[model samples]
Target: MPPSTVNRQWLLERRPVGAVAAEDFRFNEADIPVPTDGEVLVRSLYFGYDASQRIWLTDDGGYMEPIRIGEPMRTMGIGQVVASRDPGYQVGDLVEGFLSWQDYVLARGDGPMPLRVLPPADHPLSWHLGVFGVGGLTAYFGITDGLQVKPGDTVVVSAATGATGSLAVQIAKALGAKRVIGTAGGEEKCRWVVEKTGCDVAIDYKTDNLDARLRELCPDGVDAYFDNVGGDMLDTMLLHMNPLGRVLICGAMSSGYCDVKMQGPSNYMRICTYQLTVRGILLFFYRDRLAEGAAQLGEWVREGRLHVEEHVVEGFEHAPALLPTMFTGKQPGKLILKVADPD
Candidate 1:
């Protein structure tokens, strides 16, 4: 006989202060859910930690409502349906949504996290959590729709070795940027971004002087800045930007730091003087049109034009601790927590 399975989850115990800790979340097990009418029970496979999810943990949640005490931590993940009460979905269907930090999710077909079926398991489910999901699409649109990069343009992507940053570096090249520079916090990551992601120059911010390096790397001035690490990096890049430069605001690594220590950017004047265009992008805005980019990125990955990486961890127990690494820049790539495999 098969062993009994239970749904294990982490509930928010309290809001995080500096770095997220195990004390902030309480883990417990519950009976695997039975789907009601129009609901499907999806057994989660791989869940990923996004930098934005940290914003939801704070009392002042920026975009969406904050996760309250005693609520399941909101995360994006992929799962295979084990049982179903909805005609639109059936058993064995892999789905994607705001699957929480848990083993299973009972989702309605039309809920806020509407039950959308995923592509067949051609690649690892983690890829769905990457290029096929938010990371690749964010780069696709952030470049095509936001920056509109051109040949001979210099595009510098901060957090270059990250899931999104890695893709952005490659996509910038494919989109005709003659020079693509990436920034990471360490030498190992810096080397990976250049060697693996094909970035023309990789700056290790932890060791090198970023301002001095940027001045040296882009003597013509930065034509486009794809900012993922926003703090002093953003300010320094701002000072080096050429006229008509565009700054794409994908993530704010700085805003969160300031939230802890109370600080803001000192580079507004540079933006004004350079006549730069600054627009903050939200993937939610591209919801309906997401497949266009996802398909393109999927083709690129399959064609070996771009590569995607995952910083995968096994089991749900380590999730709380694993999430803090993104903030600290210790994670290697798109951080995926593998929970289970498809039946």
Candidate 2:
């Protein structure tokens, strides 16, 4: 980082009442600060845009404390160290962590460096922020550990066209599911899931009869349900669950956005009737096993068994506009904002 360089940041302006507004996030430009002692200054390369980012804006907050008003929005980013004062990270070491929506950041210590120097080479650099990143790891662990997909089990994934669900559906196939089913919105997403993503069937939950379609797709019963979109879709999936079924509660995008009472599942009692095992995943809980998850996903990517789709957005100027794309179904796959090219 040079003293003359200017850093642009997307700061949280105000918490939103419902859907994120352009005014909720405001942009600012500042001089790039130099790395202090025991710190590394990195140039931001990419940003990971997850649905959970919306929840992070709420007053009550989700998982972690909400991003403070008028501060740089907290996000996962891939970056390359431009200057180093830390022993752990060298100049040009590719790392991923709590990099904000800014052009440059000061990584102070190991606390900020979770996964170090491990960007994808076989695939594009964006994969490190998408498929081989947190979203991909969520699908891998949520399936392999949370759901534990078996050779002949019937597995279903909600929001199957989204980042985590899409990967989860394919991982189940790679793990040898007898039948892999997905629930996506609209014809294009449904067709893409079944035809391109290798799911046995795709239920267009927006227009189709979910109950009828699930029954047709999983004749025996749904052995595992990898849920991303919660609310009514979850309730329907629950009704068709097999005995001793596994439900990986990867995310509740709907319940997080809407009033929980209005959108909450009514068929939760099915969990008791079916003797289903339900596990919620937060990704951070499996921090110790991230390497194992990444290695396997990377291998699957190399073998062409796993395919990753990244909806890459360029420029720091577009950061505020891109944040709203996730909630509106405008983004095609995993959303990543590319800020700077690696030198």
For all candidates in order, the CA lDDT equals: 0.82, 0.82
> What are the TM-scores, per candidate, against the unseen true structure?
0.93, 0.94
Clashing pairs in 1: none
Error of 1 at 288 (Å): 1.2
Backbone clashes in each candidate structure, one number apiece?
Answer: 0, 0
Best of the candidates, TM-score: 2
Q: What tens digits encode model 1's per-residue C-alpha lDDT throughout 263-320? A: 4469888777878898887888887777788888978888898978877888778878
Supply the TM-score for candidate 2.
Answer: 0.94
**Poorest lDDT segment (10 consecutive residues) of candidate 1:** 255-264
**Stretches > 4 Å off in candidate 1:** 1-5, 109-113, 255-263
What is the C-alpha lDDT profile of model 2 across 177-211, one tens digit per residue?
Answer: 99998888899888889876799888888899999
